[model samples]
Target: MQVAVINRSHHPLPAYQTEHAAGLDVRANLDAAVTLAPLERALIPTGLYLEIPPGYEAQVRPRSGLAYKHGIGIVNSPGTIDADYRGEVKVLLVNLSNEPFVVQDGERIAQLVFARHETVQWQQVAELSETGRGAGGYGSTGTR
Candidate 1:
């Protein structure tokens, strides 16, 4: 719940926009604007260092508004920040549109969501259990 964090940027700490919001809006920390041409991808810094608890991770996701308005999307959607990671949080963003996209300092670029995950140990089984649609994938199930 209470994860330790260090803020190195001038922007305020990341926070949820609303009461029921699942992710906190994280801002871009840059000295100057960074522009991404069409199909260009860049790693944008957040200047945030986090100390997440064991069995938990921080997920960095794209903002819908930025994706819809400026055709900006995270190259690695929902990037995972492991509990032991102590480096700055960086977002991999790509310009999806024909026009260039500008990333400004203090602009909310990504959403950070803390999640609890389970550690799995391999059972080393030769076969997996069968299911109703075993081995069916890539739209093998109809869209209705």
Candidate 2:
């Protein structure tokens, strides 16, 4: 699906590294580097504005390589960009390691994944249909 976007950064538009990648890698748009102390979080800009279509959302996700190598992660894990939102995309990154992590300009800091979503209509039901393990939550179903 084609999407409408405006890029104001020096870096190229977000792109999929592989032929079958689910997300497009986004870069950090900054004049200088940002250093994040351990356990610290910062909002980094991408200089990207998007017009996400209705019935869809753009999710900001962390790169597995960054998380595994530098302990960098998105503060919201999957930050949601609603269809109606029209603003610059920024990533909230947190340093989960013991040392500081530097966020360089044009660095691939996060990923943007576009996905379709459903709008929910409230039924206001008195009860939901019951089933086996009707009230089970979380680990109720044994992990196999």
Q: How far out, in Å, is residue 126 in model 2?
A: 1.1
Q: Indicate which candidate wins on lDDT.
A: 2
Q: How does model 1 fare in lDDT?
A: 0.95
Per-residue lDDT of model 2, residues 3-94, tens digit only = 89999999999999999999999999999999999999999999999999999999999999999999999999899999888989999999
Q: Among all windows of ten consecutive residues in candidate 2, which has the lowest summed lDDT? A: 135-144
lDDT of each: 0.95, 0.95
What does candidate 1's lDDT look like per residue over 1-144, in tens digits? 899999999999999999999999999999999999999999999899999999999999999999999999998788999999999999999999999999999999999999999999878988999998889889989954
How much RMSD separates candidate 1 from the native structure? 1.3
Tell me how candidate 2 scores on lDDT. Answer: 0.95
Give the Å shift of residue 112 in candidate 2.
0.7
Clashes (N, CA, C under 3 Å) per candidate: 0, 0
